[model samples]
Target: MVPNVRSSLPVTGTKPRTSWPRKALLILGFLFALAAIALVAMAVSQNKPLPKNIKYGIVLDAGSSHTNLYVYEWPAEKENDTGVVHQVEVCKVEGLGISGYSQDTEKAGLSLQHCMKRAQEVVPEQQHRETPVYLGATAGMRLLSLQNRSMADRVLSAVEKTLRSSPFNFQGARVISGQEEGAYGWITINYLLGNFKQAFSAFYFVMNFLNLTTEKSPVPLDKATSAVESFCSRPWHEVKAEFPKIKEKYLSEYCFSGTYILSLLENGYGFTMEKWQNIQFLGKIGSSDAGWTLGYMLNLTNMIPAEKPPTRPLSHASYVGLMVFCSLVLVAVLLLSWLTFHKPKCLQKGLI
Candidate 1:
């Protein structure tokens, strides 16, 4: 006899099964509760302070005792155990500033070029070469006679020849003021301490002009980017006019974030919340801190910043236009010089 078969089926026309939807709702509720708890934990953990990227490398022939080159970088993952944020040391340059030099590097370009070649060898990343490199002389440069420190051509020429055309890809160096220096110092402290999220949170949500409730932030930022965008539009001074209570602390946050974004745009490097998904308050380009220092010196001490004027700036965008115009001008000048030196025959030769 064949094995008997058994089947159990619902009664005809009975109500259809409906347990799947109920189970899904239950799981979702549980997940929502877990997420809420996690958010609270994250907020509370942020209270404790942390550290900063002390990424120093040599910029000049910095002698051992006085050669203290301060390096800053976004901590690397391998350095996490040490609580470091900087992974790469992007830039370094010799001398404090251009105003400290006197030589025209046109004839001596080779020697300057050799020094830069050695410097660039340390870190060969193409991107690092373009990071904003800056220089600012100390009291030493100030002591030089006007003739001794005439750096307009020497500095510019040296950069072009020595550092392989701005080895750190600096648009230019600017002398900043004391206020700026203080601002950077404040940022450096906070960055080292990891006090940004809370500091920012308090400023945007808790301490608005109206003192809005905690249920929502006072500012209309749905996310960090939007908040930053609003801040960028107004000068930090203007923003501080509204809040006299925590003016110093708030101003520090404003400057750090503002300078980072400005550096990102100016250097063709984009900084984003995405880059900062797991990180906090630091940047890739060198000299925000240095800029902060120069800023303080200039703003507070009432000093002047100097520069090397561009020897040849191609106004047109395309290389073809630049080459054609520059070449024609050079040839004409050479011909004129020859004619000036040797009259009739030289003039005829130039015309040909």
Candidate 2:
């Protein structure tokens, strides 16, 4: 009875030792998870969309007195949206309006070459072919069309030819009606003032009276009228001496223009004496002129959408982040399951 030794002795409690292969597998899995997390972070940081792309457009406002080229720009992604398009540059063509070249219709087109070149310089070279260039002749061309329809057509054709030759996508040149001009002018002013997005029901009127009479007179109607008359009564030389900076041509017409504007507002538009205070004579709303050119472009390009576009709940970044988190959780669950189900046989036996 060797010290009454038991045939089967209870094994002492000992810690389970993991095999090198299992340890390596666990370390490799951890490293792989870290690499995956780093890869996701890199993708999120580096693979975002590029900077906002700018789109360009050109509008030629061929008024009764002169022609002006306006270069406009907006974000490319928001094409059919409002309050995005804005004027960048405005180049006035030297000499008279396109309609003035009725005698030598070919000169009408040539007159626009300078402004066209300016537009080319203003807009990026890559966007030339796609950039739409429009020519809108106002009262002058309308008057020309009334006086001589054939001549107006020829004048328009000449300008069209010139525009077509340019790198931009030339839209047709046409003489716009007074009503159309007024409506577009209204749109332009309101658009620049951001009235469309506001909660208001007030009506706005735009009078494309005369560009020469844009000088804002900060006085009552009667006083303004008397002042204009007094200014007109003075001798041309004396007036020129008093205001040397004023162009003689424009200076001479101030009285007539001032009177004409007053009459037009009071009689033509039917505004009362009290309502006169509401009249706002603005050459520009912001950087862009308060005129029909911007409205014309907006209509042609359908930049102002009829209805708001539908939107998703989550932002792009948020959606991506959510997806990456879900992917990581799934990978972790799979790795844990694999480690549990594919444990070494020795380790399983030791546990038992």
Candidate 3:
């Protein structure tokens, strides 16, 4: 009976226990991945500071084709003149741009007034026009017909009359070249990047040498930029273009400088572009090159539409995917082992 038991032992099939170290290692690897992702998520979240109100802003985007009023406001304490800007809303009117400025000055002024009227509803009463409104006139304003010009003057005069009579003051209007406008947009974004809000912050004080300020600053030429109609997702620009400020040159320049897509990149994400006959990496921006400069600029404009958030946190999906893959691998291993371990017995027993 003892000999028969020993012989039967050779025929017995059993799975050996897996190494404890292997199981521990596998579990530890999964935990490590989760921790890494969470750490990254936390870092990204922390990097985005809450919106600050360095100060309020209002813009009159005047093109030869049309005109529109853009209003933005923020908390007084959190933001500075150049800090993170929180946009309230953009209020506009039909036929506001240069058509109002050029073709019909009276209508142009009405459009301007209408834009301001709508903006007044959105901006809070307390933060309301505490400071004077900077009425900046651009190309369309620069090119009005005599009748249109007189109409524009009357419209602005009426606007000034309203401001003087109201709780706020009209700080007089000024015409700026497109270059100055481009510089301002750059400045706004950079201030947010540098974390100093006021136009007169310590950073600017320290960096003013780099700003293009000179005893005789060159003025930008009156050039028309091409339009990138594909970029403007909303019809607001149509309202904007109604005034004729829309120009080919301005559009092209605006497209290159103010790409909403830049807002979407995170610190860890990267892309490659072929430039100067070389494939260049994007993530680790270095020494203020175009890619890195754009990256830093994008860091400030995080609220751009192109920077829309992900549908969900990466953890749940990534972890579940990893688990599925690991489980599939584990099942494959068990199947292979069962087939291998029993192959000899199956053959010997004529069970194959």
Question: Count of backbone clashes for each model?
Answer: 24, 0, 30
Give a tens-digit lDDT track for model 2, residues 1-352: 4664554777686866658657767776676676577657656665666555677789999977689999998766564454368899999999888888999999999999998999988998988998888899987899899999999999999999999999998877888887888777777777888786421111121122222224364335665566556766878789789879655765676667667766776898786777666555666676888778888876765643233444454577976787687577657756765766687787689769
Model 3 worst lDDT run, 10 consecutive residues: 218-227
Using TM-score as the measure, the top candidate is 2
| Model 3 Cα shift for residue 274 (angstroms) | 2.6
Error of 1 at 293 (Å): 7.2
Candidate 3, 1-352: lDDT as tens digits = 2466765566566665568546655665565556556555655654556553334555555555555455554334332222244444555457646434433444545556666777667665665655345556555555543335565676566545544544443556555555565555455444434653422111121112122122233212110111222434436566347536654444444443423222221112342222112211121112221111222222333332222223333466665675566556556555555554456664658642
Q: Rank the candidates by TM-score, best first.
A: 2, 3, 1
RMSD of each: 35.8, 7.0, 19.7
**Local distance difference test values of all predictions, in order:** 0.38, 0.74, 0.44
If scored against the real structure, what TM-score would every candidate get?
0.27, 0.69, 0.37
Per lDDT, the best of the predicted structures is: 2
Off by over 4 Å in 1: 1-100, 103-130, 137-161, 164-168, 196-352
lDDT of 3: 0.44
Tens-digit lDDT track of model 1 for 146-180: 34545543544454454446446533332333344
Candidate 2 segments exceeding 4 Å error: 1-30, 33-50, 77-83, 196-218, 236-252, 266-274, 303-352
